[model samples]
Target: MVEVEAAGLIAIGAGIAVGLTGLGAGIGEQSIGAAAIGAMAEDPKFFGKGLLMTVIPESIVIFGLVVALILLFVF
Candidate 1:
């Protein structure tokens, strides 16, 4: 019974970690995406830089997913 409860808590924690990270990534990406679009509108040459900047925030979600998976499987 205790093990079950502990597993449930761990699951909850994992969910929270992933959810909060995803939210943060979304917020970060939103600002970057807006800037990217604005910069692209002004100069087409900024496309590569803007795309790189926009994609950088996605790493946060990837890290979060890895952590969640580790927590679920290892703990």
Candidate 2:
């Protein structure tokens, strides 16, 4: 019989923790980049607002990272 170690389980979860965030981030950036470019195509004046709004999705990734970090230290 084989026994599972807590550390190994925690390590696996940590890896997931690290990877899961980038999905939404990538989606966010794609939309933002596309929108920003579209806005630019229409009118260059939206450059600032478009760029700022595009990066708003970055918060999700950052929050995930913080949670992962906390988990890493927790277990």
Candidate that scores best on TM-score: 1
Question: Model 2 over residues 2-75: C-alpha lDDT tens digits?
Answer: 33576677667767866787787888789788989899889999999888988888887888777778767875
Please state the error at residue 59 of candidate 2 in Å: 1.0
**How do the residues 1-75 of candidate 1 rate in per-residue lDDT, one tens digit apiece?**
999999999999899889999999999999999999999999999999999999898899899989999999997
User: What are the clashing pairs of model 1?
Assistant: none
- Supply the TM-score for candidate 1: 0.92
- Name every residue pair that clashes in candidate 2: none
Query: For model 2, what is the error of residue 58's alpha carbon versus the real structure, in angstroms, after optimal superposition?
Result: 1.0
